[model samples]
Target chain A: MRPIPPWPRLRRGLEHDYTILTVREDIVADPRTGQEHPRVRIDCGDWVNVIAVTREDQLVLIRQYRFGISAVTLEVPGGIVDPGEDPALAAARELEEETGYVAGRVVALGSVHPNPALQGNRCHSYLALDCVKAHEGHPDAGEDIRVELHPREAIPRLILEGSITHSLVVVAFYLEHLRATAPR
Target chain B: MRPIPPWPRLRRGLEHDYTILTVREDIVADPRTGQEHPRVRIDCGDWVNVIAVTREDQLVLIRQYRFGISAVTLEVPGGIVDPGEDPALAAARELEEETGYVAGRVVALGSVHPNPALQGNRCHSYLALDCVKAHEGHPDAGEDIRVELHPREAIPRLILEGSITHSLVVVAFYLEHLRATAPR
Candidate 1:
């Protein structure tokens, strides 16, 4: 017989000072045995990712400093969604801020949780189309964000060589594929 | 006028260690403006995410405690990849470890640098199909992972509502879409 799914009960867990990442203790009902078992949990800050495509139809990607991952990443332009801000607007703002590029049309690509197991926040990804050069990007204090553009078709080959290996960028590329082929 | 792109630099800046998150830094060149920036980088453990399906063609998913957010999360079956392991092999191991159901086949969906800027390591996602019930799942010492299966069409809807929000999961879904439509 198939085991019944777990039912969570956080009867007790610890909290940490850093708000972005946290861990907890909890329980779940095992599907095979139908019993509760102890487990640890983790959470991370919510973030936003944007797919900024220029007028020539090239993807506008940025290599920005991520405090979590120290390496400057060559990725789609985006940032954290401030409290009470709509994600769509956040996407547009991030695109402009990171690339000095604005969208003539903005499309909601979709949203995804970076790591649901440990983080509570959602990272909504947006696709900005018909983009035009807005201004030169100005990263935050001490930030050194550089921008680049890649032809749409070159992404798959890049993935094979692991050049465009940033997880979010890969997601953005796959989303681009879905948008092209998905039936409305 | 458009800003000229900075030449991509593969250089290191100042480095340090932070106890707060047990992170090591490898300050890299901020490609945006060509400045020396002290970026905080860390080597996070590797991770695995799966795109598993049942005999009925429903997508396999799981929900468990996320200590960071102090909430329950519905997510894809996944785990940390042991050091020196191929991501595709790790993904298959996670599917069976968390779900107890064995798949007839496992394919590399794709890989993503979930958080490249600061964190080290990669997240390998995979597609597992033609599954059958195995023995009870064997979770880690403190894990209480629960498994569930959802219809294929339901995925996109869940994504919008923030239910199915894991970044790796979202990417895996889109990859599945691409494989489904590409010319065979």
Candidate 2:
């Protein structure tokens, strides 16, 4: 397929800084008709999520209250990847911090753009095998999390039944499924 | 499992309106300690995407330039659900408008929160069985899209090969897979 030409930036507009994300506006001209339009862009740090499984094949999951949704959600351990930090190490750190699960081995599964239409960040997924509890979890000041362990086979059912509804979490499991089923 | 209590809103801070999304800040008190903290929230309309398959079993896909990533991306046809519009109907409308494909029948696959930590919206997925070209697509003024068809079996490879990197698209395909493999 031929590459789609990108729009030319006309000027930069206002920018608003939130703690986790920054919103900015850019004026750009369409390549086809040269029509100018203002597009909103969200700048965020790359994120990392781990599909950590125990030696007994139990999946480590977390239930936390998300402020945006105003409710608790079931998701994998994840957080923003620190600046200049390796995504694999970030994945391992997040896993251990959120659930106290230390990984025996960590490997990258894949990555995806959370929302390329408005966000410029990637969320990297990792598989942490043979995980075991190392210490008490240390959630952030605003975070309250409960860790749960389930059979790895129940992931598909959890997702299908809507118990797990975070898009990034679902993508992580999907990537893990692809890796497990791939031809060696 | 016990339910996690929600934080109480202390006050509303500021709100900024963007064309596609609205950003606002809310001051809320933690349930455990009553400590107040500011949280950023992004308000967006619900969204819908269609996994359209032709009678010949070819998957309908589209390539379009996303301003957020500043590049072209391979994705399925989708758009924000209009106010009071049924998500299934919106899915069909988006499919027709973005790719000019009309579905013989449409069924709901499932839904997921795009980001419950920051965005309060759901992205609903649908399966459009037996889709066919109806007319030339009519994308929005800022949209320029190219439609392509691929065998349904190639989706996993496309995703794994990083040709399709949108989180919502990956979630949609994962939901379809769960539906296809569910025991009756």
Candidate 3:
């Protein structure tokens, strides 16, 4: 496959800052036609999510009210990767802070651009093996979360039944599936 | 499994309109603390993506330039679902228009919230079986795409190796995996 040329940006300017994300507008010239077009990009820090599994082969999950949908959702513990923080460490930190589960070993699963078409940041997913409850969770002031544990085998069914509908959460599980099924 | 109450929205106002997405700000009161907090939501039409498979068992995929990431990405054919349009039909239309592959039959795999934490819209995925190339693709004026076909089995490795990194595309494949592995 031939490499596709990138569009040249004619101009760019910050448009809005919404606390969680900042939007920018860019006028880019198409490589093929040299036609200028307006495009919007959302900027934010990278994020991390962990598929934490305990020694009992149960997965630690969380339920929280998401304002966008105005409903509670089942999802893996995750948060933004703070400035100058390693993604792996962020994953471990978020897991413990949100669920109070500490992992014996944390390994990188994979990372993907949440929405490359509109967002510039990536969301890294990690696998935390042999997790154990250390203490009650310490959710942030704006967060109210409930942690739950389910058998590892129930993930696919949960996703299929629409019980777990977050795209990033599902992508994390897909990465875990690849890790488990990969030829060693 | 206790029920988590939704936050009460005290006020909402449109913040920005970025063509593809509109941002709105909401003053929501925490159900637990009754404390008011500002939250932002991105509003957009629902989306659809198709995992098109040919008679020869090859998967139809596309490469396109995404402005947010400022890079060409390998992804499945997809686009926004028009108002009042059926998601399955939208999926098939996207597949045909973006890749010029007409499916013999299309089936709904599943639907997911792209980001329930920040976006209200759902992305519906479909499985388009026995697709055949009918004509050259008709991408929108702003789109420049290259279509490719790969063996269906190559999906896992492509995803594992980071050749295919779109979260929505991965979710579509994960849905297909769930469909294939579900017990009769």
**Candidate 3: stretches off by over 4 Å:** none
lDDT of 3 at A172: 97
> lDDT (CA) for every model shown?
0.68, 0.93, 0.92
- Candidate 2 local lDDT, residue B163: 99
Top-down TM-score ranking = 2, 3, 1
Docking class of 3: high
lDDT tens per residue, model 2, A75-118 = 99999999999999999999999999899999999999999999
TM-score to true structure, per model? 0.74, 0.98, 0.97
Q: Give the true-contact fraction for every prediction, in order.
A: 0.59, 0.83, 0.83
Error of 1 at A174 (Å): 4.1
Predicted candidate 3 versus true structure: per-residue lDDT over A4-122, tens digit per residue:
88898999866788888888888999888999898988899999999999999999999999987889999999999999999999999999999999999999999999999999899
Q: How would you encode candidate 1's per-residue C-alpha lDDT over A17-53 as one tens digit per residue?
A: 3343544555555444556665455455557778877
- Worst 10 contiguous positions by lDDT, candidate 2 chain A: A1-10
* Clashing residue pair totals per candidate (backbone < 3 A): 27, 0, 0
Q: Per-candidate interface C-alpha RMSD? A: 5.1, 0.7, 0.8
Taking the tens digit of each residue's C-alpha lDDT, what string does model 1 give over B57-176? Answer: 988888776644546677888887777887777888888888898888888766667777556667777888897779778877556667887898887667655686567777677666
